[model samples]
Target chain A: MRIIVPIKQVPETTNVKMDPVTGTMVREGVEAIINPLDLYAIEAAAQLKEKFGSKIVTISMGPAKAEEALREAIAMGCDEAILLTDKAFAGADTWATSYTLAQAIRRIGEFDLILCGERATDGDTGQVGPGIAAWLDLPFATYVSKIESIQDGEIIVERMVENGYEMLSMPMPCLLTVVKEINYPRLPSLKGKIAAKQKQVAYWGTAEIGAQPNNIGLKGSPTRVVKIATPQVARFGKIVQPKDEHELNRALDELIDMLKQKAIL
Target chain B: MEYKGVWILGEQDEGRIKLVTLELLKRGRALADKRNVPLTAILLGEKIDAESLKKLGHYGADQVIVVEHPVLRYYLPEPYLNVCKVLIEKHHPEIMIASATTTGRSLMPALAVKCATGLTADCTELDIEEETGNLIQTRPAIGGNILATIKTPVHRPQMATVRPHSNKPLEPDPQRQAQIIYEKVDENLLGSRVKRIGFKANPAETASIQEADVVVAGGKGFKKAENFKMVHQLANLLNGAVGASRDAVDLGWAPYAAQVGLSGKTVSPKFYLAIGISGSVQHLAGIKTAEMIAAINNDPEAQIFQVTDFGIVADLFEVAPLLIEKLRNHLPDKEA
Candidate 1:
């Protein structure tokens, strides 16, 4: 079996904050790390490698610094890693990104399965996996939580939905966008980390992937971000602290009245 | 080729049209009227009657399109995408909208790619540009720290999957009438390599956070899983759904379905009560659309207070029981 995993590097969202004075993102200290959800996809690939004795190739499409994310995946048990970086890939929307990745995957030749995180924290689109599947004419599933079996050139998995979970079976050479419930990602081994450092990472660009200039970057993107604005949070912030029992009673009465007025009671 | 009409990829559940579909109709009506074009609602299911199909007209569909097949009963990506592609090729709609549900999220991307069109997902704000009549889509990005407005400048049939609960459904008008069209397509387009074998509903979820009008959420301050009982009790008293922050769900105190945040569910409830949540940017993203918010925490300076209309600084243990008592006493006799 040959399994491919697509990962992304994103800003650590927890540390992402806005500067009150400028009303702009405070990007100075926000560290870029592997998208947290993608860890589950990597772990799923690693477990599949452990069980089926297959090779796991992890791929990422980002700036050159994204190589660090690929190396971390290798430390976590990926057999090899590839980085697709180019100035032409910049400003690409999900469509362009999916087209570029699909082109690279085509260059890699045959593969049984591809795994991706449910969505990236930055884009939050969750569209690329299915978009790639469309480009490749492959069957795919999203929010996959469990892989029940993989045999006879087919795979059965459990996927999460709003109401519950659905068990599905798809042919080989399929794609899955996994949820966090799939597995608890494993920590990298010290020896694996040392090996990852010594391993060479291959860098691919638009030319290497043979991507069409019309569909590889900003020019290829169908959608454009015309404007960006911060949402203004509006709240009264009516805070009250009652130190004594009488004060507590008064506060409780006022709260009940407010709730009543809102028809929440 | 002129893309000419507004279309809603309508959804139905258990033979009845879903609320989100109606919500889209309400919003789609405005966009269609602005562009001086007809609005169409397309329904795909196994067995929907004409009576139910015509009801879409009452909600603002100038035309109704129906495609019924046993294979189309359940949503599978390939077959659905194939059928939608065929429809897009035939109709050449200018704008298409769908709910940002699992079904839409699964189908739209593939459909957009197959047709080589642009689709924006989870759009909270949508409008038509005055000059070009392009659909303007606005949605939160970077965990709600910034909102980006996007547009498909050069693609036909501009598509978007709108967030649920962002708009209410319009009032039904029995007087309104629509032309209904039934389509029959090639069987080969319905072929699929995937099969859905079974479905199991999440048993632990007593109420759906997305559908709830009131959400009572707990955070890490509860300290222990058992402490969630009070949160549940409060939710029960208020007739609300139980919600949790990522920390609570991560610690196994709550199920993932009950989590509300960037990685979880986005809830636009009429009222949200945060218990001990510090309101991370991701967490705030989920509830930013809520109509009213209140918080109860021991720390007066908790970040949650910054976004809440009301804040009470006190021990949750004391506050929970007392608040429950007060609500029980004040609730009308029939409600209590």
Candidate 2:
């Protein structure tokens, strides 16, 4: 089996801060990491490799810096790494982004499975995975938590629904967006780290993938961001807490009174 | 092709219709009246009850178009998409709406691609432009830092999937009625490529935090998984459901279903209590609709305190026992 895993480089969600005056993202200290959810996809792919011997080719769509994300995947026992980057690919939305990825997948033909993270933390829309499947016309599943088995030209898995899970069996040449519960990601071993250092990262651009000019970038995106504004987070109401015992009793009384008045008790 | 009516994709299971679908039906009603078009609901399921049908009418649907099949009972996108694709191509409604759920999100984007249309996901606000008659879709983006208003200017059947709890369902009027249109589904097209073996509901789903009026959420300040028991204990005392910040969930202290954040479920509860949580915008976005928020964190400048109405600058471990003891003493029999 030939499995292709798509990974992304995203801003460290915790450290992201908005400039109060300019309302622009302050990306100074936000270190880039392989999207947290994609780690599970990598782990799932490695588990499959261990069970059934196969080659793992990891792909990423970002600037040259995204090569680091690909290298990290190589350290996790991926056989090959492909980085799709170009000035033309900037500002692409999910639809255009998926189109670019589909072109790259076409370039890396003869693949049995395409696996990706459930969603990116920065862009939580989760549209890219399904959008890619649509572009490539492959059966796909999102929020996949468990892989039951790989049997007779198909893969069985459990999809995470609202409060439960459903067992689905799709043919082998499919795409999957996995959740964190899929597997526990393993740490890169010393041998794997050295292999990552020696790994050759292949870089592809629009011309390399033979992508149409208009359908590869911002020009191809259907939706337009007409406006962007920081959501105002003014405190809801006054904060009330007691300073001492007397105040504690008074605060408790006031709370009970308010609830009673609201008929919530 | 003339785009005419307003369409709402009413999602359902065997017997019950989803709350988000009813919420969309209510909104669809107003949009239909504004455009002077009939509001139609397209439902796909094995068996949909009359109560669910009436509720759809009660919320604002004028017509209910159903595609029934045994395979439709479990959602696999292929069949639902096939049924909806055919109906949409034939009807060519001006606007189409579906709930942004596990099912809707999976189905809509593919269908949108199939129909060569545009779609907006997890929208917090939906409106129509008076002059252009375009759908105005607004949603929080870039980790809830900014709200972006997007428009699909050229696409017909302007489509969107709204966030689940963003809108409330209108009161169901049993007296209301709908013209139920049953469309025959092509059995051969349904479940051809992908197959569903079985499905089971997680028992924890029954205690849905979105439905809880009071949510007691904890963060990494709980230290470890074992110390997290106090959160549940406090929830028990308050007659509330237990919630978790993404940090707690990431640390494996709580289940993903309990996670309260942008990537997880949005909650609009009456009273929300945060313990040891330094509120990130991602977490704060979900609870923004919470009526009353209280925070207990040792850090006086913890961001959680900024959003809540009541904030206590103290160790949560110490505060937990005191609040529990006081609540027990104040009202022994009180439920909420």
**Candidate that would win on DockQ:** 1
> Fraction of true inter-chain Cα contacts (below 8 Å) kept per model?
0.77, 0.58
Question: Candidate 2 clashing pairs?
Answer: none
> What is the two-chain DockQ of model 2?
0.56
The digit string of per-residue lDDT tens for model 1 on A1-265 reads 9999999999998656555445456778788899998999999998999899989888999999999999999999888899999999999999999999999999989999999999999889999999999999999999899999998999999998877888999999999999888889999999779968998889999889999999988999899999999877546568888787677677778777777788888
Q: For model 2 chain A, where is the 10-residue window of minimal lDDT? A: A256-265
Instruction: State chain A's TM-score for model 2.
Output: 0.90
Among all candidates shown, the one with the greatest TM-score = 1
| Model 1: residues with Cα > 4 Å off, grouped in runs | A18-24, A249-259, B204-207, B331-336
Q: Alpha carbon lDDT of residue A84, candidate 2?
A: 94
Per-model C-alpha lDDT, please?
0.88, 0.82
Candidate 1 chain B: worst-modelled 10 consecutive residues by lDDT:
B327-336
CA deviation > 4 Å runs, candidate 2:
A17-26, A249-265, B204-206, B237-239, B325-336
Q: What lDDT, from 0 to 1, does candidate 1 have?
A: 0.88
TM-score of 1: 0.96
Residue-wise C-alpha lDDT for candidate 1, range B198-297, written one tens digit per residue: 9888764445788777899999989999988888877877788899999999999998888898888888887899997988878988888887788888
